[model samples]
Target: MKKNSINRVIGFVIVGLVLLAAVIETGRSVYTWSQQAAKQPRYTIVIDPGHGGNDPGKIGINDVPEKDVNLAISLELKEILEQNDCRVVMTRQKDEALYQAGDTNKKVADLRARCQMINDSGADAVISIHQNSFTAESSRGAQVFYRASSQEGKKLADILQTQLVSGLDPDNRRVAKANSDYFMLKNTTATMVIVECGFLSNSKEAELLTQASYQRRVAWAVALGVLQYVSGGLS
Candidate 1:
């Protein structure tokens, strides 16, 4: 019963994201009828909002936590995808660790567990959310990364970053290929792309990252980018 309740809560949150995406998609559709009656989309998109629970990734100018931002944007992304009819799964809902407490090897075991969840979900693709930080605030903009082992991973990264640049920012931040050393990217069985949405350390970008409106737009860009890739528009 406890596990079932947790699953329900998770589902509600995921469905909320899907609904937000649906509402946006419905508004943009050629007509409401097409959106209402369209057959279910043929893809399942697993959204892994990185660094939750005690792992609060990069701290921003206002001390905004990276885990919180990732969750917010990830929820928005799930909305955009579900509006377009994609099934979605999330790694964690509240700010809880994926692994049980008191585990000796927590970090690696936890990360691998997250990957196992994605692999078990039978998702077509996984998008791991993260925020970036560097000494250079000038290093602002979105970047998509893929595992070196997967060729299609490169294509997915290209499409997502291209769409983000063209639709959200015209600053061509470029796509990167990373080896399995990145934990999540290296271990997930599904076609995976990790997104460094923007640099949080930069004052200007940090301000934008904190806004709900901008987050939704970023989510939309990501959703469309993946769809474009899936539809063969970015090949």
Candidate 2:
């Protein structure tokens, strides 16, 4: 009897998520539909899905790997961006790491490779996706970070933050933050932002992050943000 009740409650949550996710996709469509082809954004974006292979990143509710969730959302974002006629580049498309064979320090090697790819690609911008986790389980919601000194990075981060808050979680009071100590931000020359998609440490948020529909919603929110940045639409 208890199991049945739990299942029913889960079903209701899923239904509600699907509806909100649909709104996410719709917002992207409406914006693109309203733009003229001559003015459509023609830019290349490098999407880095943080962690993979040996590095599972943060373990969340149900033991879901943050690496897998990151890749899923990134792939969705790539597709959405491409559908809007933007060129997309991915650091790693499969379940693998960017480190070379027999690399002594896998983490450093992987990051270097990702940075090289972004710098060499001449991409208009770069976005590294990762799941967040905090000791405090109550800390949730997505957050954006950019290099403190880069105006371009700040612009992208703020625009993306707005999209994330308004489109996915209006309750997320977090704003775009600037950091100067991050390796990825310092190494990559292009405009870039790191998006912590949500707090995996929060049980309720972890469950939501694991859902394919919710992942797509997060991707849509990001896609809309990227499009807006590339098109010079600040709002």
Candidate 3:
């Protein structure tokens, strides 16, 4: 062959080898991913949408109830989790309190019932969805809370806080906090995090929270956080 022809043939051989290597590497990566996916533990999570029925939790400036927002976000998160092969148990699927309609101590009874459900769920984790309200209408952003004593809860809370701020609210300054006051976090046997999605007191935030698209984003962030935790990303 002529020198130019030989050079072209050599170049083609090199390109072919490079392409073959790339294909092999891609196949190996795919195999590794499949193995990891197959070995991944199927985690069960309890999703508690706070306050229902007569208990609206917080009333937003836009006249949207916190219970509705909470439920909406929780339902979206459940769908996302289930799509990822995780089992989800919702504490309440509708706008009704866990306690009887005529119970005098309905609030307490409802909380206790939710705690019972969480404890009995045999879940890998619990995420209680809620919206915050404050005296100041300017207050905004999402916050995450976990039991102070549970390291796992703290890790999950940290992941959720990071994801929410980065994915949904870029200006969100709220960080993960430790709390012993929440019944869901304090009483649940499984590692739990309470995601205070946004402030209903803030007009801007309240409007966004009431939107289906924003609610879905919030749910997506929460679901991503849980998936990260389960995939050992925290470790």
Number of the top-ranking candidate, with TM-score as the measure = 2
User: lDDT (0-100) at residue 172 of candidate 3?
Assistant: 87
Tell me which of candidates 1 and 3 scores higher on lDDT.
3
Native-to-model Cα distance after best TM-score fit, residue 44 in candidate 2, in Å: 0.1
The models' CA-based lDDT, in order, is 0.84, 0.93, 0.92
lDDT of 1 by residue, 1-235 (tens): 7999999999999999999999998777857667665666778889988888878889998799989889999999888888876888888766766777778787777798899999899887888989989997677888888998888888888788888888778866566656667888767777899999888988888899999998888888889887887667646
The best candidate by lDDT is: 2
Error of 2 at 185 (Å): 0.7
lDDT of 3 at 132: 94
Question: Measured by TM-score, how close is model 2 to the native structure?
Answer: 0.82
Model 2 per-residue lDDT tens digits across residues 47-87: 99999989999999668999999999999999999899688
Off by over 4 Å in 1: 1-41
What TM-score would each prediction reach against the true structure? Answer: 0.79, 0.82, 0.81
